[model samples]
Target: MSVDEIIEYLRTLPKGTVVRVLVMDKASGHLWSSIVENVVDGDVWCREDVGTLIEDKDKKPTPENIDRVLAAVPGGLSAFGDWLTQEGWDILRDIYDDAIDALR
Candidate 1:
C-alpha cells in the first residue's frame, strides 16, 4: 500500500480517542502495541507505556502536556507508513485488547 493509503487509514481513527491497535511482524509472528497520536503530520507518535501517557507531572491525556511520545524514532506519520512499508508489518484494530491500548 502507498503511504497515502496508510495515512488515510490513520485518518479513520478520531484524535484523542483511546484505541487498541496491533502491529504484527510477519516474519516472527511478534506483536507490538502502539498509540497513534497525530493523524495529520508527525511521526506515528505513541507512548509505548500507556501507563505513562499522563506523566507524573500530568494527570490527563490531553496530548499537549500529557501525551509524552519520544522525540527520536517513533515520532512521525510518514515515517510510520514508510517504516511500515520497510518492515512488512500489518496494522489491525482489536477493540477488546487491553487498557493499555487506550490513548488515555
Candidate 2:
C-alpha cells in the first residue's frame, strides 16, 4: 500500500493505539522493537529502549522524549514498510483487519 493509504488508515485508529516497529543499530548490528504510541499531525511518535544501555551524562531516554518520528508521507511510509520483516507485516495487516472489523 502507499504511504498515504497507510497514514489514512492510521488516522482511523483511536488515540493511544500502539504500533510496533523494529529499529536497527548500525554500529552494533543489533535490533530492537519500538512502539508507536500516537499519531499526530502526519507523524507517528515513537518510544524505544535504544539509548538506555549507554551512559550519557548529557542525554537520557525518557518518556517525554520521542525516539523517532515516522513521517506519514509516501517516502517515509514506504521506507517503514520496506524495513518490516514478514512477521511485522503480518502484525500490521492484523491491525488493519481489526480496524475493518470494528468499523463493520
Candidate 3:
C-alpha cells in the first residue's frame, strides 16, 4: 500500500494499540505509543507521544532515526516493507520470514 493509505489506516486504529514506536536522534532511542497522522510529500507522517526515554535526551526525531526505529521493530514488518521498496520484495521477505521463524 502507499504511504498515504498506510497512514490513513493507522489513523483509524483504536487507542492504546501496542505499536512498536521509536523516536531517536543520531545517538539515542525512545519508544512510544503511536498512530499515523498523514503523509506529506514522500514521507509518512506519524502521530505519536514522545517516548519518555527517547525525549529525555532532548533530541528531535529525524529521517535517519525513523529508519533506525523501523529497522528494529518486531515482525520486522515495517523494515521489510521499506526494504522491499528499495531492495525488492523477495529478498526482504526471505530475510523477514527467516527472522520471524527464528523468533518463534
Candidate 4:
C-alpha cells in the first residue's frame, strides 16, 4: 500500500487502537518496534516500549527517531510486512481484509 492508502486505512480504524510497527535504523541496521497508541489527522502517535532495541540499549529513542526511521523505510508502510512478527502481521492482515470485505 502507498502512504496515502496507509493513511486511509488507519483512518478507518477506531481511535486508540493498538497497532505495532517495526522501525529500523538504516545506518546501523538496528531495528525497533513501537505500538501506535492513536492515529490523528494522518499522524500516528506511538509508544516506545522498554524492550525496544534503542530503549533496551539505554539509548534515548525520541519521537524524532521514530519518525526518521519510518521515513527512511522504503515503500513506506507497505514494507512493514518485512519486519512484523507473524502475530503482528496476522493482526494487521485481518484488519485489512475485514475493511476490504466491508466495502463489498
User: What are the per-model numbers of colliding residue pairs?
Assistant: 6, 0, 0, 0
Stretches off by above 4 angstroms in model 3 are 1-53, 78-104
Number of clashes in model 4? 0
Residue 40 displacement (Å), model 2: 21
**lDDT at position 43, candidate 4:** 28
TM-score per candidate, in order? 0.25, 0.23, 0.23, 0.30
Worst 10 residues of 4 by lDDT: 41-50
Error at 76, model 2, angstroms:
30
lDDT of 2 by residue, 49-78 (tens): 334422253465543332332233356756
For model 1, residues 1-104, the per-residue Cα lDDT tens digits are 76579778878977766554557555643455444545332233344343265555466644444234433437555675587656542332343355447647
Candidate 1 residue 43 C-alpha distance from true site, Å: 22
Better of 2 and 3 by lDDT: 3
Clashing pairs in 4: none
Question: In terms of lDDT, which candidate is stronger, 1 or 3?
Answer: 3
- C-alpha local distance difference test of each model: 0.50, 0.52, 0.53, 0.60
Candidate 4, which segments miss by more than 4 Å at Cα? 1-51, 82-104
Please state the error at residue 94 of candidate 2 in Å.
Answer: 34
lDDT of 3: 0.53
Cα lDDT of model 3 by residue, 4-89, tens digit = 88679878989866444334332443333343434222332342332333456676655555566656767676665576467555
By lDDT, the candidates rank as 4, 3, 2, 1
After superposition, the stretches of candidate 1 with alpha carbons farther than 4 Å from their true spots are 1-4, 36-104
